[model samples]
Target: MSAFPEFIPSKLSFHLDSRLVTAVAVAAALYYALYRLQKVKIHPNEPPIVASKIPFVGPLVGMVLDGGRHVKSIGLLNRDKPIFTLPVPGSRIYVVTDPALAAAVQRASKELSWTPLIPELTKRVMGLDADTVGVVAQNLDPEPDEPHGFLADLHDMVYAYLGPGESLNALSLAAARELGRQITAHAAQLEQQSETVDLLAWVQHFVTIGTAQYLYGPENPLARDPRLEQAFWDFDHGLGRLLLGFAPSLVARKPYRAREALVAGLEEYLSAGRHEVGAAPIVQRRIEIAHLHGFSVAATARSELSFLFAGIVNTATSTFWTVLQVCARPALLAAVRAELAAVVEETATGERRLSMEALKGACPTLHAVFLECLRVGSDSYTSRLVKNDMLLAGQWHLKAGSVVQIAGGVLHADPGIWGADADAFDPARFIRLGEGKVLPAAFRPFGGGKTLCPGRHFATHEILAFVAMIVLTFDLEAVHSDENISVPPKEDRVLPVHILEPRTDVFVKVRVRDARAVVVV
Candidate 1:
């Protein structure tokens, strides 16, 4: 069946003759091969060149198939090279390996840009209409009439909502409280009898509900469907394909269905006046931004779904990884719990609660564990479209219109930057932050420069809050007879948007912690 509806035509009414098509295809193939055959030369100011065996399409295909793995394969092979150029047909992409070069790339935004990619992403991933795309383009104008216009660049507007300060804190706090509340309720239910559950699955639901509750407010749409949490995971599983303009309806059918169902639910939720309730500043601003840009309610709802995806999907995965990293190591887990002991309070009625303020100030070990998890599990890649030819680091000449990629995993594992244990999970990694050993660019799990993740602060708070509830409130053990804590194999991981999540959900036997287990500071 065709991906488009029955009303749509399968092909244009007019077509070139078969013989002409054959001739054109042959010419294009010859052109591509010749393009590959041309003796490639790298100038002194240009980075070393690495050519894929398949000419124009090899690098793109490999990246599409296994993003992080492909990057690692190249990054590891060229340990001595701070950077390299991958030439694909019409484009030249510079991949940064060294932290110092990465910093230079971050500052070279004028020559290497991010604006053009945003509209392209929206059109493909969000399936936005041409008119809406125009609005996004206008907002992205670097010099708009109003410097702080609500309808400023899409990135800026999004940053406005998620940027640090009171607005972000309020949204984050609300989400943390809701997640904690739900986890406590779930714990209460499990306390009646010893129960088994998929550990990752439960945390996914908890974070999903908590995030949805805070973002969409009391009239949360995910609450309307029992299967939405799973549905979202299904869609997320195929996200890279969908984002690459693969016809998701045909290639990722289940994910497409899941996305459409969620979109419909979100549309209905807004129609029922649900967005009016629990509307935080971010949500309120998003709605206003869309309205001001001439999007209909349905279009606005669809746009919000993308933001909601950013808010919930990757975040839940990050939370799961953080917990798994901690739980997988007993010494680390004990240390983390002990760090929390200073801020954990047991009430007269035997209820235990974490003081967020105290944890923020006192829980250095937990913070270190969180940072280490991000470094070890991050798959985030930053891209910039080169606008003008320029020399990078006064050495490598970057070509105009080429795409530059800064792979977080590469920087995270840099030996000189992160030390001998760069590839190992060192929970106390960030404890040495003040020692001036690690470069500022060495630990950019949330990315850096203007394109830094606005949700970084919020995500950090929520993950810590959720994990605190679990470790402080429950005793957890893997249910499988042969298992203790089996982390998902690194080889099995696909390049996902956030930290890699286990391919299979982790099941555990859980019981409320005994009073003695709760450390009273």
Candidate 2:
């Protein structure tokens, strides 16, 4: 009863206790009144503001609690206004639901920019050092012929090498060949053991090994240590927390330790100069640029972790879902296999090969299925910071320094844009897209504009090749009869920067197909 010292002898203590009591009372009142503070004022011509029910902390709290659904909640108000503002603690985010407004923001490139955010995110999420962050921010938004930041140079280097040309083709060829080898060995082992395999785990392992083989080479750091594979996923899943300023080393110890451990392995790998030993052209050049920008060997390795994370995680997750979708539908599975089989040819020497070039365009249904899975399963946002006050799309004033969120979940499911079956899986959807009947903006699983994913082509080819290989040669089914293969439920808090991984483990019985099939040559 006397814990608070109601009869305190010290005046200063009494004063502090009284102030603390008032502070606690005010905090309680604010918490209780937040629900009633739902009407946010909107000035004429200003973007309509959606008052979050939780007062100052609403938007971020919603994100933490509901994932992409919170962004969609902001979108609910978009029906009345093409653009609306989501008020955060000290700032506002302009949410654009109308595709036309989204394109305007995309084209208004300079006024709304990814420049300021990218450096900050890199520093926070990737856990880059102060020197490295300086290097990354140095050339941010460079003038023509002016010195660009390490990131700008690095991005240019990535695009230059990943584009349609010798470099990209070489990387693709190496990756496809190595991936085939890994699949063949793994599938053979699976058939021999006739075991229950976690569908997502098998896919993640093969894809990581295959992708890492090309990025880091045969003596790859990840493959050398089996634990690193799971570590990568652990680190990826915790990215949102890291980005939200919950970045103390102990706050997210699991991912932080895993990431640092991987970085240490990468440092050890690079120390031996194995990156030059048959590394992808992209890898070699990225290392050069990192060194030019003053990154130490350890820093360069740490930076490459981003590439490894992106290359493996997104493609692997999508591939797992694509495989699941095909398995669940009989007609789609048969059609895809038929399309793939037709593309494979037997050689005089008795070896068969499916032309990678042919796979890119020949299998229309496979393309549709892959794209549809992405569209339906994707839940993310593409954000750009507002650099100046401007009239957006000739209406709606967006204040300077505010942020704009281009939500994929809302766009992908918009009935007006995608027709009545927008929410359903239609593998033939891209067929129409190919026919030029629909606007390209309607399908944005990989995002669009100046920020369009540079790894799209690489990722697409890799995913298709991997999915095609498994489905064509292996027969898979869920172990429990009651269990079914379908799009795994998404988590409550999926990150925009993440590839969609199933919320739970998907276990299946896998075996070699009895039907005659083409072998990867």
Candidate 3:
């Protein structure tokens, strides 16, 4: 007692004790709440068989990582079922597998609307303003009610710049001749080298040049400018980020220096103001109409770039796959070549080249080949969110705001619709149609109804022409005789990303074919 000091009380001890008690209570309450949530069975709205126990953000995180492998795996597991539900960020997604159910979802676009995920992504990568981007415009209160706001205006401008009609007149006989010359020049260089090149890359360059020439005319220096080439490369490089669903605001925050260079090149072309007297055909007429409708030329030009991006990328991918498949399959390849030879021989007038009609008639096999490739390698899908509570597949009453997806990959490979060898690549599958043989609802590669790709015809023509030229000029053979070719593994984090993704790297050695070697029937 003599050595001990007098005991002292401190206000800090009392404060610390109270705070500690409050923290523990809050933590305990959170734990109890989470435990209860885990115990609670999913509502009848969610199918019992579907896996939905993933915490918080759910399976979306995993789906984003690797092209929805978990979703696809679950789809295979539950193939017999009509519908299943899985958790996604902020909501649960119902995946519709039954053909009828998918049709219902696709048809109900007015009641169930598509979310413009990709368009939003495009806005970000293009480095446009939030208002120009149109994301969350509905929520901004006091939004403009004009019949044609930014998006509609942009669409009209793009249509004027590159859509079908007189607008495409500049892209006529002379343009075609120039294109042919350019293609031949490039092909000759390739033939001389005898080196295996990535056909898709070369085709992309060709399409870009052809598209620019059509939009800006031959006189515009940007049409032949080397600097424009670098800008396009930069624009393409930034595209991968958009496909990954990185925040548009973030991508927009950084100046797209390369894209700016492209825009600058375009400005120089616009400044020239040199119009070919008789050149204002369909394309020029459309531009006049656009101007009359109060469309801004600058806006039209910006929108045209978007058109160029969309027009070429998927078409190039499709063409690549079509050529690769034809070259790799020996019997199919031989049959196509034989068909072409017969057509050319029948129509050949010793002096003039094959007419458009003759070329069209000569390539039915080529069309069939293209269709088969589209069936197997189409990278598009349809999605919608429910607007009202509805029972789907005679089970699972999905509430309003729930998202639904129709799995195109699964549908394309469906054994019931396509036969036992659905997984195998067979061009013959599309060549003949039996009487009253119904195409399965699952056969939607261009999507269905209103949302179907509008440029389908243009794309088909482009692919056929490119394929015809390649097959006509070269004898194609696989570099590795025993190599197996298949679709590249799906990377689906970003919807619609599959359209331009390569399925596999195929090496084809091309040798110049004699004009008489293959008859173009």
Residue-wise C-alpha lDDT for candidate 1, range 1-521, written one tens digit per residue: 66766435424322345657888999899877766653274456778877676666667788877766786678778878888887776887788878888888888876777776777787767667787777666634365464533235456767876777777777767877777677667667776476787877777788777788888887777888867777777877777767777776897687778877777888888788788887676787788777776787777877888888888876777777777778777888898888877677777876666666666668888877777778887756778888888888888888888888887777877777777988787776678754467776666777877677888878887777877777877777778646777777443236646777666667777778743222112
lDDT of residue 369 for candidate 3: 81
Give candidate 1 regions above 4 Å deviation: 1-39, 42-44, 139-141, 144-154, 157-161, 433-437, 480-483, 491-493, 503-505, 514-521
Best by lDDT: 2
> What TM-score does candidate 1 get on C-alpha atoms?
0.87
**lDDT string, candidate 2, 1-521, tens digits:** 77556556576788999999999999988777764553453446778767666775788888887777778867854666677877776678888777787788788887888878877788777788888777777867776789888878887888888888887777777777777777666666666456678888888888887888888887788878878888888888777777775644877788888888889889988998878777787888898999888899878888899989878887887988899899988788889989987898877865457777788879989988888888877766778888888888888888777899887778888888787888677878678756666555556777777777898888887778878778866888778757666556766366666556677877888887632333433
Global lDDT for candidate 2? Answer: 0.78
lDDT at position 38, candidate 2: 36
The lDDT ranking, best first, is: 2, 1, 3
Query: Residue 175 of model 2: what lDDT?
Result: 74
**lDDT per residue, candidate 3, 452-510, as tens digits?**
55556556655666666667667766566466333354334444533544644555666
Worst 10 residues of 1 by lDDT: 7-16
Q: Estimate each model's TM-score.
A: 0.87, 0.90, 0.73
Alpha-carbon error at 388 in model 3, in Å?
4.7
The runs of at least 3 residues in candidate 3 whose Cα sits more than 4 Å from the true structure, single-residue gaps closed, are 1-49, 68-70, 115-119, 134-179, 187-193, 219-222, 227-240, 243-260, 267-301, 345-362, 387-396, 432-441, 480-495, 498-500, 514-521
